[model samples]
Target: MNNTNTVPLVAILRGVLPQDVLAHIEVLIAAGFTTVEIPLNSPDWQTSIAMAIARFGDRIQIGAGTVTSANDVAILSQMKCSFILTPNTDPAVIKAAREAGMQTCIGCHTASEAFVAIQHGANALKIFPAGELGSGYIRALKAVLPKHIPLYAVGGITPANLAEYLRAGCVGAGLGGDLYRAGQSPEQTANQARAFKQAWDACQKR
Candidate 1:
């Protein structure tokens, strides 16, 4: 959504608490991350998202992940969130997010799901548990997937193997615990974010 030719790296804050979420996000922003997702499963996620948007909406794109229902989409829309990410390829959720003027990234593990998600107007595809599926799986999927559709590797993604996924044709990735654990200090998270940015930059050079 940043509209750059380079791949977008999403910081996935699964267990971040509202009180500390803004601090962590500031660290991420300083390290060059523009996209961030706070999973709805986190405690008071709505508040975290709202805080992030209110404080730094112009500087970063904040959104909600683990979103499953249209009702959640409506809430995010009202909150003026930038995007919606779901763990599964639910057409209704995708449609709702799109109608609400939010970018949609639907999770998919199989080719069928990927196709269905694309058909439902997903802006991107999140290949979840990508570590288990490997780059080979992505290569296989790429053969059938439209070239314009951006594929993002999520789950178990680390700086070491991120390039491999990129070479396999994935456009981006969702960084979770590898980037920020719930209890990690903001300084620690900033260090990890820098490492990931370096890796992504290196891959782009190749």
Candidate 2:
């Protein structure tokens, strides 16, 4: 779970292999990504999530994304997930997560949706399909959003333009394909994850 005070570069492992999960997260943690989100849509995602929590729960904020139901929220929280991310706003799911003590980041496309999500107690707002909107869209959203709402760009974040997203007022960002492209080796994924963390660091220095 994220807060307005701590800006994090969230890593989304959309199709990351189980064997690569620990290795990649180790590299990410070393590179300064203390927060990571694994979508349940991945193969054996629950097992992967458990492995991550068991291995790095003490030091890293392990979470699940693509959540759309209260059931997922309950189970993941019971699994000791530190954070939760949803592709869309679900007031009941948000309330359930809050009651379970997990931080919530729900996807929203417009200011009204964002405002509604915030009103429902979302800790952060994820601008889904962020690439489609581009940094310009984020800037427009930022202009109207409450200064206290943490907005993280996801669904197309990468090293090439992480700085641009940050400049657009996105305090944090999340990436899937750029970091964990399919058909890659565990070692290759580890390497790319490290590179991603480096990019986040570079964004921060700017």
Candidate 3:
């Protein structure tokens, strides 16, 4: 986390390739994003993550997403990943990630899951399928969660609707398909990243 007041938007490059990943990340950083994740399911994901970290780690936070196992944690730890994003809360995975000195943003959909993730040492909570669940659900969750817990809305998030989640108390969002899609050109990514950055800046002003 950069720790500035700027909303920490995470660029979830779910299908980016190793050869093209850096170009996309360059434009994203230029548009003011400081955090990015390459899902393990993507082609050559480990290589892409390593490349990103080697090139931009000092300038931004780079990590792996859709992580599920402790074995994966060990590999990422060796690479010095700044954080790990999971699709679901798994205590073992969380414990491993924490022990490896990586920030954990475990995904959750209910209060029970949220609390459980927190107890296991998640640094943040990602509300998966957030657009489907809507911001009202996030507002309700925020009410009972510790005030310091940062909530991030993921899935189906876009520039047009980011403010709805923010006003409902989410600190940021994980931008997936709306932010980047497989085969898109670097120019396309630049346009979308700038749009998202502008949207986040606008939301903070309100």
Score candidate 1 by lDDT: 0.91
Error of 1 at 28 (Å): 0.6
| Tens-digit lDDT track of model 1 for 13-102 | 989998999899999988888899999999989899999999998877888999999999999999999988889999999989988889
Candidate 2 lDDT tens digits, 54-81: 9999887899989999999989988999
Off by over 4 Å in 1: 5-7
lDDT of 2: 0.85
Local distance difference test, each candidate: 0.91, 0.85, 0.93
lDDT of 1 at 81: 96
At residue 187, give the lDDT of candidate 2.
72
25-86: candidate 3 lDDT, tens digit per residue = 99999999999999999999989999999999988999899999999999999998999999
- Cα miss at 17, model 1 (Å)? 0.7
Name every residue pair that clashes in candidate 3: none
Ranking of all candidate structures by their TM-score, best first: 3, 1, 2
The TM-score obtained by model 2 is 0.92
Question: In model 2, where is the ten-residue run with the lowest total lDDT?
Answer: 1-10
